[model samples]
Target: MKTILITGASSGLGKAIGEYLFHKGYNVFGTSRHPEKVLNSPFPLLALDLNQPETIGRCVGKVIEIAGRIDVLVNNAGVGIMGPLEEIPGDEIRKHFETNLFGPVEVMKAVIPHMRRQGAGHIVNITSIAGYTGLPFRAAYSASKGALELLSEAIRMEVRPFGIKVCNLAPGEFATDIASRRYYTELSPASAYAEVYGRTLELINQQVSGGDDPVMVAYEIEKIINTPDPKIHYKVGPFLSKFSIVLKRILPDKTYEKMLMKHYRL
Candidate 1:
C-alpha cells in the first residue's frame, strides 16, 4: 500500500481526500494543528501548524516513523484572507504567507530527502482558482497561491531527475468551512471600499455555499496519482471557473478585467 501524508485533514477537502484514500487501501496519515482535539477520524491525525516550521518537521518525522515511507505528500493545509490590499494589516499579510506558502515549502523540505532516498514520490500542492487572476478583495490569497503555482512548476522540473513528481491541483470554490475560517479585514462604513467590499464578501460566501462537492477533488487527486506522468497543473471546479483561465489567456487584458468587474458588480 502506498503511504500518503496529507496536511490540514481535520475537515473540508483535506478530510474528504484523506477518507477517500484511506478506504481505497492507501495507508493515509493526516495533519492538523491539534490532532488530539479532532475526534473519530478515519485516519490517524498528527499535530502540525503551518505557521511553525518546527511542527512541520516533527510531523513529517512522525509520519515517516509510522508509515516507513511517504509515497505521496499533499500540501493542502492553508488559510484564507479577504480584504482590500491597501487596508489589510501588514502583519496579517505576513501571517497569511507563513501558512499558505512558506509553511508548505517547509513541509516539502522535510519530506523530499526521504523520498529521494526511496527513489520515488509525489508531491501535490492544493492551490486556489483565485490564484490564476487578481480577484477583487482576495489580493493576498491570489498572490500567495499564484506564487505556489509558479513554485510548483519550477520544482517539478528540478525534482524530476530525483524520481519525485510535483504538481499543483487548483480548486475553485468548494463546499467547505473556509469562509468561516478566513480573516476579513474590518469593513468600515466610511471607508472607500466598504460598499463594494461588503457586496463582494456576500457574493463570495454565496459562491462557496453553492460550490461543487469536494469529493470531486479527491477523485481528481486519485487520477493524478495513478497516471504514470501527471501534468504540472490541474484545475477542478465549475466549468466557468476552470474556463476562466482560458478566457484570460485568449481575451484582451482589459476585456477580461471588465468581465470580472461586471461579474462582481464593482
Candidate 2:
C-alpha cells in the first residue's frame, strides 16, 4: 500500500482526506495539533503544531520510521487571519506566514531528501483561492497563500527531474470550521474601518457557513493522487468559484477589483 502523510487531519478537509484514503486501503499517517483528541481517527495520528517549525523534521521522521517510506505528502495544515491589513499587528502577520507558508515549506524540505533518494514522490500544498485575489480584509491570509502558490510552481520544476511532483491544490470556500479557527484582529472602537470590517466579517461568516462540503475537496485530491501526472495547479470548488481564476486572467485590473468590491458590498 502506498503510504500517505497528511497534515492537520484532526478536522476539516484534512480529516476528510485522511478518512477517505484510509477507507480506500492506503496506509495513511495523519498529523494534528492534538492527536490524542482525535479519538476516532481511522489512521495513525502524529502530534504537530505548524507554529513550531522545529518539530516538523521529527514528525516527518516518525512517519518514515513507521510507514517505511512516504509515497505522498499533503500539506493541508493552515490557519486563517482576518482583519484590515493596517490593524492586524506585525506579530500576527508573522504568525500567519509562519503557519501557512514556512511550516509547509519546512515540511517539504524535510521530506524532499527522502523523496529524492527514493526517486519518486508527490507533494500537494493546499492553497486557497484567496491567493489569486486579495480579499478586502484578509490581506495577510491572501498574501501567504499567494506566496505558497508561487513557491509550489517554482519547486515543481526543481523537483521534476528527481521524479518528485509538487502541486498547489487551491480550493474555494468550504463548509469547514474555519471561522472558529480564524484569528480575528482585535479592532478598537475608534478605528476608521471598524464598521466596514464588522460588515465584512459578517459576510465572511455567512459565506463560510453556506460553502460547499469539504468532502468535495477530498474527492478532488484523490483524483490528483491517482493521476500519473497532475497539473501544477488543481482548483476545486463550485463552478463560479473555480471560474473566478479564468476571470482574473482575462479581466482588466480595475474591473476585477470592482467585482470583488461589489461581491463584498464594499
Candidate 3:
C-alpha cells in the first residue's frame, strides 16, 4: 500500500483525511501534538509538535523507519489566530509563524532528501483560501498561509524534475477545531488592539459555523494524492472562495475592500 504521513491528525480536517485515507487502503502514518486524542486511529501515530525541530525530525525519522518510503507528506498541522493585527502580541505573531509557516518548511526540508533518494514523493500542504485573499482580523494567519502558497509554487517547480510534486491545498473554511482555538487572544489585561482584536475574533467566530464538512477537504487531499499531476495550487470548498478569487482579480482595490468589509460583516 502507498504510505502517507499526515500532520495535525488528531482532529478536524487532518483527522478526517487520515481516517478516510487509511480506510481507503493507504498505510497512513499520522502526527499529533496530543497523540492520546487520536488513540482510536487504526494507523500508527507519532508525537509531533511544530514548535520543536527535534520533534519534527524525530517524527519524520520514525515514519521512515516504519513506512520505508513516504509517498505523501501532508503538512496539515496548523493553528489559527483571531484578532486585529495591531492588538496581537509579538510573541503571538511568532507563534503563528512557528506553526503555520516555519513548521511546514522545517518538516518538508527534513523529508526532502529521503524523497530525493527514493525518486518519487508528493508533499501536500494544507493551507487556507485566506492564503489567496486576506480576511479581516487575520493578518498574521493570512501572511503565514501566503508564504506557504508561494513556497509551494516555487518548490513544486523545483521538485518536479526529481519525480516529486509539491502541492498546496487551500481549503476554504472547513469544519475544524482550529477555528475554535483562536490563538490570537490577548496575553493579559493591558493588551493593545482590543477593539480590532474583538472584531477579528467575531469575524472568525462567524466564519467557522458556515463551512462545509471536514470530509470534503479530506476527499480533496485524496484526489490530489491519486492525481498524476496536481496543480501547484488546489482550492476546495465554499462559493465564497470563487467570489473572493474573482474579486481579487477583477475588482479595484477600493471596491474589493468595500466588498470584503461587507461580505465578512466587518
Output the number of the TM-score-best candidate: 1
> Candidate 1, residues 150-190: lDDT per residue as tens digits?
99999899989999999999999899999999999996789
By lDDT, who's the top model here? 1
78-193 per-residue lDDT for model 2 (tens digits): 99999999889999999899999999999999899999999999999999998998889999999999999999999999999999999999999889899999999988989998
Instruction: List the candidates' TM-scores in order.
Output: 0.99, 0.98, 0.93
Residue runs of model 1 more than 4 Å from their true location after superposition: none
Stretches off by above 4 angstroms in model 3 are: 187-200
- Give residue 192's error in model 2 in angstroms: 1.0
Cα RMSD, model 1: 0.7
lDDT of each: 0.94, 0.91, 0.85
Candidate 1, 143: how far from true, in Å?
A: 0.4
At residue 38, what lDDT does model 3 achieve?
A: 61
* Model 2 pairs in collision: none
